[model samples]
Target chain A: MMKELRTAIRAIIVFTIMLGLIYPLAVTVFAQIFFKSQANGSLIVNQDGKIAGSVLIGQSFSSPEYFHPRSSFAGTGYDAIQSSGSCLGPTNKKLVEAVAENLSKVLKENPGVKAKDVPVDAVTASASGLDPHISPEYAELQIPRVAKARSMDVSEVRALVDKYTDGRQIGFLGEPRVNVLLLNLELDRIKKVSNRR
Target chain B: MAGSMWFLLFIYLFTLLVLSIPLGLFMAKVFNREKTFLDFLLVPVENFCYRIFKIDARAEMRWTQYAFALLVFNLVGLVLLYLLQRIQQFLPFNPRHFGAVAPDLAFNTAVSFVTNTNWQAYSGESTMSYLVQMAGLAVQNFLSAATGIAVAIALVRGIVRKETKTIGNFWFDLTRSVLWILLPLSLLIAPLYIWQGVPQNIHAYTDVNTLEGAKQVIAQGPVASQEVIKELGTNGGGFFNANSSHPFENPTPLTNFIQILTIFLISAALCITFGKMSGDKRHGIVLLVSMILLFVTGFFFAYKFEKAGNPQFAALMQRGTVENMEGKEVRFGVLNSSLFAVVTTCTSCGAVNSMHDSFTPLGGLVPLFNIELGEVIFGGVGSGLYGILLYAILSVFIAGLMVGRTPEYLGKKIQSFEVKMVMLGVLISPACMLVLAAIGVVTAGGMAGISNPGPHGLTQVLYAFSSGAGNNGSAFAGLSANTLFYNILMGVDMLIGRFAMLIPVLAVAGSLAEKKKVPMSIGTFPTTGFLFVVLLIGVLLIVGALTFFPAISLGPILDHLQMLKGILY
Candidate 1:
């Protein structure tokens, strides 16, 4: 029995070191060398060289000049650390009221936008509160308002929207969405370039 | 929600079924101790490859030793994944030039995949780099699954052997599981997935023109390899946030079908393997039948409720096209969405071609109920079988008490020590869940996570607990769960919910290993019969329903009633 116990103990120690310590170290080293960008979080930045946010996490943008992501339950909005959605069911009165309130707010902010023109994503919160992108329709809805606000042609804003829209994997997986932070950053850049012109 | 989405979902399902069966069968043969067709055909090739790599395959271990090896392997994976997320900014392959994942999130993800749960607090496309996705997440997908298979094999060994001290070799099992099972199956399935439109390229994101003449940036990766294990292993974390709902992850209705089948294939096949290992194919079939019946029943409810859609939406829309699909993928339709929801939750596989949260109160309840049932309807790979076996032992114990005789499962006696271990394995998660939910509901901090007030809000909390405790990993996503409090709390739940049960299970394995295997007598109750199968299923249902009934009544059942009456309260 003692011999069996000793054998088991030895086995555990040797295997633990090899699997728990050595293997992981090797994989980490491999990841570091082969896939650097992805080994790191896919963060994006602004022209001012400030670390804005990751291209993955949705950020709050209430201004008309920027495209708004899906409604967020994060503290304030789009808090990455506090990622979550409002756990409201479709039939809940609170959700209905909240959606109504949000719609009113969107209408109030973006004057002359038709009620029908408002995108569903603009009103509803995503499953992940940290969803970084909005529906293409939501992006499109903001085009006129953003173009007018930034004093750029609607075509240019539309072009930028087109630029950021990610297609489905292998041309058929997910719905097309525009990363808001990326679009906004590019918007900022285009504005600066036009200013120079 | 949309007919097109339903069409696409059907295609995806078809594809998954087509691919998973052969793959699952192949995996079973590889893991079997007895030589298989592959042993004869692939021995030379395997030897050649091993020789080329200077590999040694002589390592052996007892069942307990094997379990420890798996645990230790994952612990290392957790540390490495955590560290990689912390230091990725300094690493390579980052064309977008990303940085490390936040500490808490990294810890959560590492634990999630290592436990075979694949719950994501962070989105895949944005948070993970290509390297992290492949090495950290994808690698874990394979190893974690192999770990589950290894554990199941250990448990089986305990049942089959008579007074055996050792179960099997840890190193040998792990290697064989990966090399013979996961690899060849993946090799075949990956290409099939590619042919069916799942991506298999190393090229970066590309630019494409849309129907509306908009230029879209398409996210592409080496997806086929990930998809193979992702489904086969039942690790449901998608390459994209939409998960299987994303068209890329599940392109055609055939693929959707295949993906769904892939989720349950190994789990189902493992039952057959169990019977074969026990020298009773009937035993495996009986268990499989029980699981299938439970699964089909859950699917029925989900289908009915979803097809009914929301009565409120019917009243509002006049036409009532809502079909209870507020958060569903339009391509899958109500039927497939409902089916997928039940299957994924029942199996502890979170792959969803449709959003689970969008199902009607009753529709959503089916999946939620499956989780709360302890996911024994073929739960996570190794975890699922052992979980069911634990229940099987419990059922026999209860039966023994009723009949005034010592209980036996298969040929082994269920002693007091084994009973306690099984009970601990069963009760720990629910205890953690109820306590946390109670704290969350009462506290201001907890209430802050509630986005919707009233019964459905309560349901969301219950769902979170159910998902966490069961290790399902999918979420209502409606709850504010990414907070420091939730992160820390759920992370604790994930760990304890996982290892707490695992330790007890390993203890049971050890105890069973030492027990003498008894021969079947006329007085002995045959576990491999329809009667026993019904009894086992009944016990599972009774335990789940009795334990969670009040909670369910407070959440989905009550919310459903209130919705019918249009009552806010």
Candidate 2:
């Protein structure tokens, strides 16, 4: 019995260090070498060299000049620190009210945009509150407002939406979504270039 | 359903069959204590590894000690994983520099991965850092899976041995399983994934101008390694929210075929290993056939249901499409999604290329029903095969009860103690699920988590408990599962559901290990034969149906009836 106990203790210590410590450290080193960008968080930055946000987490873009991501229940909107959706179902009254409020806000911000033009993602929260992209339709809806604000052509903005839209995997897997941060960054660049011109 | 092109499905199935056979054969040989082709190659490497570590490869352990070591090791892993999430901000590689995860959520995640469930209430790309993803979660992915395989191997050792206390050393089995079986297979497959366009990079997220002069941030990660075990171990938790649905993880038809094959490869191989260990290939064949029969049946129904589409949506939208394609990937089509869903559920691989909640009522129920059947249909790594073996024991017992003789499985007599342990393992989840669902429905606190109301809402609650208790981590995504109430309840449910079943399984292993091998007589039932295979299937269905029928009636079954009766409110 004593021998068995001693053996068990030794096994735990050795295996824990080897499997738990060394193996993970080795993998981490390998990952750092091979997948440096991904090993680092996939952070995106703006022109000023300030960190914008990760492509993974959704950011709030409430202005008419930027495309908006899905609705979020994260405290104060798109708070990555508090990553969570509204957790509201289709029939929940709070969900209905929240959707209505978001709709009104979108309509108020972009006057010419029709209510029907709003995408489902624009009003509905993603399962994870930190959805980084909006549907193509949602991106397109912000085009006119963004173009007018940035002094770019609406067609140009529309073309950008087309450019960023990722198609389904191997012709199909998921709905096409345009990353909001990426679009806004481009819009910022276009504005600067046009001003120089 | 457009992607359901018959040719594609055939190709996918054929690839899965071809790859799984060799992988399964190799895994079986590795785990069952036999010399494989890889054994010859891996021996020197194994010796070298042991030498560097200053360890002996020949250390053996009693079955009870083995079980205890595994449990204690994982218990520590659970605590460490939970603590790591809590203190991640202080940890390194956190460029976005996220803060600590909440207590309940952390606890839930810790239990989730440790139990081999890999159910994520939080998104991986955001909630975890590269450090945690690799050092913490991904490491757990390998170790947790190895743990399951070790447990299954221990149980098999128990059954195969006579008058022996030693099941095998936990460390040795775990190391061998990883070094020989999982790592080599993953190394071979990871490159294929990279070649197929799955990302394996450390390059920073690239910024490129869109055609419209818009900049887009492409989310990149160390995907190849994760993708390897994600399929190899049947640990389906994705690094991305979209899981294999994302192009980065699954780039092409070939990658998709590979992913499907990888999910079932280890699971199917374990069955062969069981047969090999028991000295009866037919015994393994019987179990394999039983699993295939159920899986194919479920697959067909999921296909048909999704293809049939929702009639209500069709009339309202004025679209003539006969498939419910909303929330489904157009590339995967209904057929592939249907197959993936069945394969994932059947094997306890929760990786979904499409939204399971968006599946039509019956289609959704198929996966849910698979979980309710206790995930034995080809469960997680080692757990699945052992779970099925438990069912095999039960089948034999029932046969014995009918024939007025002592029951035996793989030469070990299935006696009263074993039967009790098997019963406890089988029934524990249902008891937890049903009781919890009842508590949730009746209590104000429980009902508060419901975001959807009425019958469908009730079904969502039931689904949460079922998913939690069954250790199948896919959620309806229609419920608020992150709240304190859900976190605690589901956390506890997951803990009990996992360990409760596991303890009994281990106990049965210990008991069976002590039993002397019984010689087969003319009157003895041959479990490897077709008749016994059918009997095992019958036992699986009957036990599952009887135990879960009431709960099923209240949830998916009733919901199906409501949909059929046009009773949507």
Q: lDDT per prediction?
A: 0.69, 0.71
Q: What is the TM-score of chain B in candidate 2?
A: 0.93
User: Ignoring the other chain, what TM-score does chain B have in each prediction?
Assistant: 0.91, 0.93
For model 1, residues B1-569, the per-residue Cα lDDT tens digits are: 35544554555545544544455455556666556767876677555544543335455456566666656666776776788777777865554456788888888888888778877777666667766766667777877777777778777777777776777765556656666776556665665565555654445564433212233344555555677778878788887666775545665545766677778877876776787777877877787778877977888788878778766555443444335545544334455567778888988777766556555788889989898888889777777888898888898888888888888888899999999999999989888888888777887777777765788778777777667767788777667776666766677777788888877887787788889888787767778888888889989989888888898899889878887887763
Tens-place lDDT digits, model 2, residues B183-238 = 77776777666655566543444444332343445555566767778887877778
> Per-residue lDDT for A89 in model 1?
79
CA deviation > 4 Å runs, candidate 2: A1-197, B1-9, B32-59, B201-220, B251-253, B319-322, B564-569
Interface RMSD of each: 9.0, 6.9
lDDT of 2 at A188: 69
Residue lDDT tens for model 2, A1-197? 44434444454445445544555455446656665544445456667675665554556665556676666655566554443445443223454466567767777877886665554455545434455667677777778787887778889999888877776555544446677767777776776534321
